[model samples]
Target: MITFDQVTVRYEDTAEPVLRGVDLTVEEGELCLVVGHTGVGKSTLLGAVNGLVPHFTGGTLYGRVVVDGRDTADHPPRELADVVGVVGQDPLDGFVTDTVEEELAYSMEQLAVPPATMRKRVEETLDLLGLADLRHRALHELSGGQQQRVAIGSVLTAHPRVLVLDEPTSALDPTAAEEVLAAVTRLVHDLGVTVLLAEHRLERVVQYADRVIHLPGDGRVVSGTPAEVFRSSSIAPPIVELGRAVGWSPLPLSIRDARRAAAPLRAALSAAVPPPVRPVPGGDRPELLTARGVTVAYQGVPAVREVDLTLHGGEVTALMGRNGSGKSSLLWALQGSGPRKAGTVAVSSDGPKSKDPRKLSAAQARQLVGLVPQTPTDLLYLESVAQELDQADTESGVAADGVRARTILDRLAPGIPDTTHPRDLSEGQKLALVLAVQLTAAPRVLLLDEPTRGLDYRAKSELVRIVDGLAAEGRAVVISTHDVEFVARAADRVVVMAEGDVVADGPTTEVIVASPVFAPQTAKILSPLPYLTVAQVAATLPADETDPDS
Candidate 1:
């Protein structure tokens, strides 16, 4: 369905090729999962299939890219509309119509499908993608996940034989992501359409892929079965951890398969599993930063009504909820970025918000609450990766005191080149760079909106470590994310919001394990235990703690 032979793509401004000498092919009906560290050219590889690399991107192409039979170099994206359909990471950026049904029908109309057939196709796609209920809804009214589903539906209306997605699930919640992937899997199985998707959340998608393509940061595509590729990669899912431990030849791809392999190993390794890590012993436990009797309204609608909550000084607290449930609103109020009434948000010293704060500066609002926006890269303007970090350090007062920019860069995203332009990197890499900038503030109460949205498994873990480190350093970190796994792993406590009110708040263990909505993979596997990390589960093995003589 697609082919790339010795294809190299170089943008006009950059000397180095984004995609280099890529010889790749996607067979008809095959679901190829593209995995890579950020900035490794995963998106560029997908762009080749749809002619976006040299067309819209205006990059110099070295070799041939053939889609279904047409050479992509000779054919632009518009000409291949009937052959290829693309669903990108940002659904809003790709939307063309105001309503869901119209959006789905727009592409088919452009393809000049017969009206009767287009209507049927659109209806079927709406049902298939689970958008039938939302067909009449406005595009802006839908949640991010719903908007993505609409995007997929719109693309599928073209009846393209091949589907190319660039991180389709990056913005979606776990359940919504599962729905979208399931829909894609059904397309491959039922319609015989081929799929080439670049994804960050491998733990959810790896199990369903027929082939996995690992694109190293240094520019190489290593292809194998899902288990084979992940087993050898630096990044892998939780099931892969179990595979490594028990010596499974072909690593298990999914949790179900891992559980099957673990049944016997459970008894064998019971003595080796250790206990969970307790929080660090005595230290200065900081006071709670409280928002007292907060009330907020948007367009005259009461979004948050007299809500009171407290975020502690040195702990990571997460705010989670469904779409339109006021998670973003609460964060905005906390940051003073949104309008509120009758509330007192007390910070360090009750001082005015600072212009910049490494931690807990009430003097400056903008710098005191360092926020990594949902669209991470939208906030970046620096020319190079190095410059971005330097600017961030300067703004946050860390430059004078000196936090090595490269150290933070390498820690959060090691594979990214400091000399490379930020705009040229993949969306995931850009997000990582923005995160590095936000961390430069070293803000006492850091607020991140969907920090791990587009990050891959490896990048996600890096973020987890970073968040944990911040909390350990006595900084309060508050994140608004849809990833239950992330909340479980990084957050010491959870604050769930619904309809602008706090629904649940407690220790991470209690909130995640107790709620039916937020069961992370590790929690599910070690259900009775509620372990969030591999180390936590490994600690359960008796042999890890018992005497060898015993």
Candidate 2:
């Protein structure tokens, strides 16, 4: 249904093409997954399907891209809207209507569909994507994950033959992500729709992919079955990596397959002990921040109820929950910057009395508690990376001539050019920049909301290192995220929230291993085991025994 014939895309003032000699074909009723590192032209490849590359993005296309018998070059996005529907990374950017119901119906109205058909399709899509409960909610009021579902439903209502999704499940929680992926799979199998999806979170979608298209960052494309591609691919899901580590022939792509081949490994690990969880510091860990009766509401509707929490020095806590479950609201309220209808947030110190951060100035609040929100770019305003670092130093009153911020940035994501614009940086790099800005303040408590939204495995590993180092320095850190795999690796303690209240709080292994919805893939495969990550499992086995193929 979609064909790219020797396509070479190059922008002005760039010597190298983003995509070079990319000849590929995606058959109808197939779910094609595009995989690669950050900034490797995955978006460029997806944009070519509907003529967004050369037509709207101001690039030059060397060859032709045909979608459903219509050449994208001859038909711009508007003319091909009937055949192709695209959903981008940020859902809010594409929203034109105020409410979920209206956004879903807007596409059909633009395409001149009858009102009755549009209404019927809207209902079907709402049910398909599990948005029936939120049909009347305003777009801005919904959580990020909810907004993403609405964005996808808006495109799905059009009933296009080919669907292009970029990071469709990046913002969704575990169960919600499953629902959306299940709906997309149904479109491919039950309705014969062609889907071309690009996602950085391979663990969530690799098992459902019919084919894998890998961009190696060298302007080259490699296409094959999942097993064939992952056999030599540098980037792979944990399930695939586990299979490789255990020398399982025909590397498993799904958790079920991995479990079937892991009996021996599980038997071997039955008597072995997993690594111990991070120990609480002795002698009563110092209290860094304390909150009491925290409440956040919007337009008479409470998003976060009265909740009391405490942060301790040298501890890393993970805030986790489903979409619209008050995770973000709680973080914002705790940070003292977001609205708090009724709460008192105080930072501890050697002084006789604790300091209420909300009563202090912005600069003073940041010195006690710093927050890196979901969209890290919101914290950035300067034109270049160097200027941003300098501004951070000035704002934070760091007299080290911006050395502290630059040092943090280098440690988080090394080798970022000083002249590069903050907007031009990749998702991971932008996050690192924002993190550096926040850390420069040397807040006793650091809060990160959805930090792993767009990061690949390498970037996430680096982030884990940074978080660990902060904890080692006797600073308290909290990461709010839905990526269970990430939480399994990075978090010391897990706190689950739901419906404006704290539902569960405990050690990471105890909380996640018991919940079916929150467990990582490795934990699922090796049931009755306490392992949370592939690295943990690998650590328990001998080097020679782990990899028979080696």
Off by over 4 Å in 2: 13-15, 277-284, 349-351, 397-420, 424-429, 548-550
**Residues 1-550, model 2: lDDT tens digits:** 9999999999774668999999999999999999987767888999999999889988799999999899998999999999999998888779999999999999999999999999899999999999999999999989999999999999999999999999999999999999999999999999999999999899999999999999988888999999999988979988988887888889998888888998999999999998754444445568888988999999988888888888988889999999999999989888777899997888885578889877889877787788999878889898899999988888888874534788888866776778888987766678889988987876889999998887778777877877887888789999999999999988888999998888899889999999999999899999988888888777889888777542
Taking all chains together, the TM-score of candidate 1 against the true structure is 0.88
Task: For candidate 1, write residues 382-469 as lDDT tens digits.
Answer: 7898899878777777745566556776876776767888877766777888888878777667889888877777777778888878
Best by lDDT: 2
Indicate which candidate wins on TM-score. Answer: 2
- Model 2: lowest-lDDT 10 consecutive positions: 276-285
Clashing pairs in 2: none
Model 1, CA-based lDDT: 0.76
Q: Score candidate 2 by TM-score against the native.
A: 0.95
* C-alpha TM-score for every candidate: 0.88, 0.95
User: How many clashing residue pairs, candidate 2?
Assistant: 0
